[model samples]
Target: MRISKWGDSLGVRLPKAIVEELRLKPGDEVEIVAATREKLVLQKADDRMTAFTRMAERRLTMPEDYIFDREEANKR
Candidate 1:
């Protein structure tokens, strides 16, 4: 862990490897969530679409074609 003094703010430096592993950039926003008394969650800030995207991805089922069955329509 590296420590640096940035003018008035004291900063703790996170390792580049850890940052890259988390897919975080310098300008990326983060969210700090408090789950338990001792457990604190540090996570990436979620966008409005994050939940929607995951839900859509999870609900995807492809055993058969989802497209219009044009030939079946003509038979009917």
Candidate 2:
């Protein structure tokens, strides 16, 4: 795929075969995974949050009184 200027932003036109194979449309979102300097992989974005909650659920535990200090936090 070649990158071209789209208005002020850069974009690439995916081949018709790959688009059809991935079931991608005009407004579909994809996650770009950069594996190396010359290679970029695209994946359909899943609706899973990959931040703290998922990792915390698997590795971390808390007490029953694990209260969030709302007012203290809001001050920042």
Candidate 3:
């Protein structure tokens, strides 16, 4: 249990082993909620891969080529 000060707030620096166990990083965000007198819930956001894939599947076309005129212009 590493304890450190964050400016004015007394922050608890999570130990390296615990951080690795939780797959947490410096910039990763977590949700903290009071579950009970002793339990504070911390979790990462749900994976959005399925949602994003569905949205991407709905897309009809993707940008590939624009007019194909570059070669002609180069010839000129």
Candidate closest to the true structure, highest TM-score: 2
**Cα error, candidate 1, residue 32 (Å):** 2.7
lDDT per residue as tens, model 3, 1-76: 5568889887677667767877987787566644888566666543455465776899744366745568899998
Query: Tens digit of lDDT per residue, candidate 1, span 45-66?
Result: 7774676677678995445755
Q: What are the per-residue Cα lDDT tens digits for candidate 2 across 1-73? A: 7889999999989999879887888888888876788788888765445545776889866677887798989
Ranking by lDDT: 2, 1, 3
Off by over 4 Å in 1: 34-40, 47-76
Error of 2 at 40 (Å): 0.6
Candidate 3 global lDDT: 0.67
Q: For residue 62, what is the lDDT in candidate 2?
A: 61
Model 2: how far is 34 from its true place, Å?
Answer: 2.6
Off by over 4 Å in 2: 48-76
Question: Ranking by TM-score, best first?
Answer: 2, 1, 3
Evaluation by TM-score, superior candidate among 1 and 3: 1
Residue 27's lDDT within candidate 2 is: 81
